[model samples]
Target: MGLQHTAFMEEEVRRGLDPKLARRFLALVWAQRGLVTLSVVLLFLFRLCAVATPYITKLAVDRYMNRPDLPVGDRLSGIQWLAVLTLAVLTVKIFTHYFETVVTQVVGQRIMHDLRLRVFNHLQTLSLSYFSRNPVGRLMTRVTSDIQALNEMFSSGIVALLGDLFMLGGVIAVMFSLDWRLTLATFAIVPLLLGASQVFRTLQRQVHRVSRAKIARLNAYLSENLAGMKIVQLFRREAENRRRFEGYGLDLYRTHMKANLYASVFFPFVDVMRAAGVALVVWYGGGRVVQEHISLGTLIVFISYIDLFFSPLRELAEKYNVLLSAMAAAEKIFGVLDEKAEVLDPERPEPLPDIRGGVEFRSVTFAYEPGLDVLHDISFTVRPGEMIALVGATGSGKTSIINLLCRFWDVRLGQVLVDGTDVRRVTQRDLRRRIAIVLQDVFLFTGTVADNIAMGNREKPRASIEGAARAVHADAFIRALPGAYDAHVSERGSTFSAGQRQLVSFARAMAADPRIIILDEATSNIDTETELLIQDAMRTLLAGRTSIVIAHRLSTIKRADRILVLHHGRLVEQGTHAELLAAKGMYARLHELQFEDEAGARGIVQAGEPSDRA
Candidate 1:
């Protein structure tokens, strides 16, 4: 047990020493280091005054008791001196305590501010893949609760712990000076107190760990439930969800109870040891006083110093738990800071100027993972102002092609060139800015309709935004709304229908006036009426620009200058729709399948023709 506890403490200390986060944490506190030092100095000065008060008290007691018959003038003088010292100490102590509180609060808030901003900025830089895997609740807990725990460590724990250490050292020094033998006897309980504290700290840390884990789980459950409330109601799964939530809630409650139980025991145990220390001090000091080894006044001074000494011991015990909690919080925060960015810009990247959007894929074979190619030895070229349609079934690498084009992920086996320069050679920001994409899943931020449309060009005038919306036929519906362009969109534009959001997305893309446009299943989720509107918008959006359209519907690709039929990550056919139909290949089969479905809906079947097999 002892070995295990030691190892745990060592691990916690090691995690707390992460150099990057440690530097950040130190920088936060370092800004106020001068003020903190002044606060400490003032606190120590107050302790000095406090220490002298007991001596003054001893002198007054000795004078009044042993020298009662002294001259009235001398007694009055002594009493006045003691009163003056008492008042001075009281005044200094009060102001110093106030100063310490103010300084600690300022330092704590500054550190928290820096930490929150740093964490939020780092989170923004992290890849989308990280967010896809981690729960929102867990991330929020790290940002909020974890940082709060560290705040406690800084605002109260560190200051109190330091002051206690100073008081302990001062008391021991004074006690030994007064009477070393009795002082030694009074400190006999030190080892026992230390041992008990270490044991309780270990237990408290374990309890805290369990409690934190349970809380994270509970938070995850709450977030998931809230986000999927509509789905739960639609499927009538409220009872099941309630049961699951109760289980998580109960687990969190039990863990919190256990932690509180451990804390409850820890303080009382320390209090018992404190009581023992006080009893030892009085017993040993009484014997010394009886033997004339120490004067009554001196004994009283020793007792006062002992009381001051134990105050820090008690404080140290209380803050041990906070220290452990801070270490845990720091470990989790540093874990994020330590994660290396998987995709980074090159050290010396060349800039591309006046790009003409002539894209070429030279033997490009790519995969998300090693030894598994999703696009194998694929080669293609798209000249400026060309429209290319990629027609394929589900999981046929169409989206992967778009992902590579946008440089969301780089090709592994070969090079992708834009305007005779390798995409990897140019800055990612410059490459992405030149391209605009309208995806099947249209996302709208919480803002006015005009604002959403103008997202691509925030500096664009309201006239340009309205022009884009009009070109996409979205202006009619938008103007019909309560506030027209100024109407606010709810979260994800839940107020708008799916087709309306897609049209707004189209307008957003059009507003950018990008050199290249990508439509990846952009019209798949829209109705026929909306699709017609988007088609008209696409004609204008794609004019004088390179375009790539990934579509499943055969009707959408009929007008493409060239259609590339992909199968199993390989391009099977490439030609105009008419030319492919004449060839009677995969494109022809898919076309027949779609045409037959239309004919079947019309209650018509051609004689002597086999049913479409796509």
Candidate 2:
């Protein structure tokens, strides 16, 4: 049947990635093994050049720049050679970084694409029940925002963390080699650094988790508001909604603030510790240099190594945030992925091929939720090419029957059979292809009028599309619009009137050319004149097909081959309109009520409800 296309994807993006999903993300990273390996090589090469620069400077200072004892000409050539070597090393650093950025970013972007596709595909496979429970905004968040967190992590997190560790290791090795005593003194502040880092880590995790959930809430709220913006304005809810949104915004703000607060406290803490380490090195190494235990060049290199060592450690901390965020996002993405669609094709599906439409519900039972049956022990049979009408009070399971007929849901007990084959035995795709349903609420996509008429059957020729519209009597009005059949339909076909949209929906169903046609209050929006035009066209439309109609109109129901009256969830009566009136049950009472209701508005003796439907 039809479902509304909502604008409720008005979502707020949060920076979130998953800690639990990290290993799986690593597998994604590892999937691009070649790129990852290249990045590693480049990172190491970059760090090597970085560490070598100071050592080269030290060599130049001790052996060439400081050695005035050599011939003046020789010293000048030596200095020039050292300067050229330093420049070459600097040039290499630039290229290494350039290549590293390109590879890392490409791999990161690819991973993000794959992740979004995975989540979207998973969502597609999920049952309608799953969608009924989850908000569109939340799914939109996972695909758009949560996955974006992984992109940040891929571009910066894991790679940076590894590279920094490698750099830290190299610097530590170089420092210890230069002077063990000085290296030991420099490491005195490391324990304090670790403690502060641990504290920040805890704070960051809590902040990320809270931010993830709060941002999801914000997105859901915003989506709901935007979709209902008309209602909000009509009811003067702007001030109240704004206040509610402000509360959500404040929660999000506090979440970010907590993350930033820890980050703010962390950097200064790290900077202080770095300075302490540098000071320790300067005091200890300077004494050694003064006593002639170590050369001034070695002392200088040791201090340079200290800065190199601490810089990467600081980088790793920032990278940790990205890692945590990515992990959180991955966790959310995987949560959706891990859930299997409750409704799926059977392993050995029976074929539903080239058949006349005859539907039978044999002792069928169903429900939207467990233990609360919406349809109970419902048994009915429609002959091939029969036009059956279902009249019911609210919650009488008419729509549920249509849902079952289409295999939108399986029967909980007994069987719903199409041409004597159990509906559950066939693939849903195949079964639905044989049924065309037009509901009260029609959803029109953005496309040309002809394209909207064709719907997903994109290969349908212009002639076929035009023919479908003509068959539904939609062609005349469609031709009146700008550019006629080629005219563009705005989002949800908003440019068209409700009656026009319904006509297009009729055209779409007509184009499908199914054996079974279901119209659930399909003529509700049409003006009486247009409804008459549709009713005339529908006779031809239903000439060979089995039609199941749920409408309040006496004109529509009176023509049905048989009318089934329902009360609560039971099929309480079944006969023709004349027969049902002769029986004088719920059908007669409803008929009388609808006659009075339409009399006040249309000044016609037609039976139809103005404000309610079963």
Best by TM-score: 2
After superposition of all CA atoms, the RMSD between model 1 and the true structure is 5.8
**Model 1, residue pairs in steric clash:** none
TM per candidate: 0.85, 0.92
Alpha carbon lDDT of residue 583, candidate 2?
A: 91
Instruction: Give a tens-digit lDDT track for model 1, residues 389-421.
Output: 887666667877887887777888899888988
Please give the lDDT score at residue 396 for candidate 2. Answer: 79
After superposition, the stretches of candidate 2 with alpha carbons farther than 4 Å from their true spots are 1-20, 522-526, 599-614
Give per-residue lDDT, candidate 2, residue 217.
Answer: 72
Error of 1 at 93 (Å): 2.4
Error of 2 at 363 (Å): 1.0
Question: What are the lDDT scores of the predictions, listed in order?
Answer: 0.75, 0.80
Candidate 2 RMSD computed on C-alpha atoms after optimal superposition onto the true structure? 4.3
Report the C-alpha displacement of residue 552, candidate 2, in angstroms: 1.9
What are the per-residue Cα lDDT tens digits for candidate 2 across 1-614?
Answer: 00112233222224344344666778877878898899889988898899889888788777877777999888888879999999999999999999999998988888888878888888887887777777877888899999889889877877777778888888888878877888888888898888888888877986776677677777888887887877999999999989978877887798798888888999988888878877887888889988988877888888788789888888888888877776666777777889877788989999889779999999988888889888888898999999998887667777888878887777789898999999888888899888888877778888899888887677898898899889889999999989999999987787888788878888888898999999865565458898777676677678789999886666678778998877766888899988988999888898787655774675333333211112
